[model samples]
Target: MNTLLTSLPKSTPLPRYATRLLGAALSATAYAVCLPWDLRNRAETAGAINETSPVTALGVTFLSLSLLSLAAYFGIRDRLSWTLLVVAAPPATLLYASLSSHPTQDANAWPVAWAFFTLVLGAGVLVAGSVARQFGPRAR
Candidate 1:
């Protein structure tokens, strides 16, 4: 058994950035697919939902994804930069909520909010990864 194990090549783990990127992509895709399904399900079973209901669901999903990503980020060998990425979730969520909410806002604003959230989240992740590469513990 020891001889066979030694003969096999060691599996290499993915880099921190690659994993983070993947997690973000998956989470975004899940959100996209689940949101409409959730809305439809709610409407069919519970009647018309309040304006804030969808938003609240979205927030919960986002928070769950963020926490999962953070947990994955912690497993990486280089954690300094990934910390920034995980830490941005709360503020980003608040910004998303504020921008997407208005008593008088129309349905048109929903698409805009989705786009804005996607862009901001992507940019933040990229920046965090870059900063981690440049100034993280590995740099020293």
Candidate 2:
């Protein structure tokens, strides 16, 4: 039994770390939702809804959940999480940009850019977290 436990992957899964990942991912999601809200504020004045509203909401939700799922993946430090997050980010950005009501070309580009930034950051988190989990020590 001891030998079997010792042979397990170093990067098994840590519940505490997983919780932190979840919290951070959820926070990222909250930030995502705030993006459109901020944009909406800047576009006109008072809070308003447009065609992009649902898109923005959906984008925020997906990104948030993606991030959360990524964290959960990292809790296990699985390679697939890293892969999915890296791949899914760009399309999500496109979807986010398309949903935006930004006026100028440059302005419209910010949401996607921001999304990319967050995704990159999320990737970092996943990589680091996964590595830590992998290198972590075994119990006696």
Winner by TM-score: 1
TM-score of each: 0.37, 0.35
Best candidate, lDDT: 2
What are the per-residue Cα lDDT tens digits for candidate 2 across 1-140?
A: 33322322243557434533554455445445534343443423355432234346666566555555444443443343543444344345544654464566433556667677657655655655465455534211
Shift of residue 132 alpha carbon in model 2, Å:
3.7
Clash number for each model: 0, 3
Give each model's whole-structure lDDT: 0.46, 0.47
lDDT for model 1, on a 0 to 1 scale?
Answer: 0.46
lDDT by residue (1-140, candidate 1, tens digit) is 33211211132344434545655455445444434223222233454444434546666567546644543343233344453344444445544554445444335565576667656665655554555355333356
Candidate no. 1 TM-score: 0.37
Off by over 4 Å in 1: 1-37, 41-54, 57-107, 135-137
Scored by Cα lDDT, where does model 2 land? 0.47
Segments of candidate 2 deviating more than 4 angstroms: 1-28, 33-36, 43-77, 80-95, 105-119, 135-140
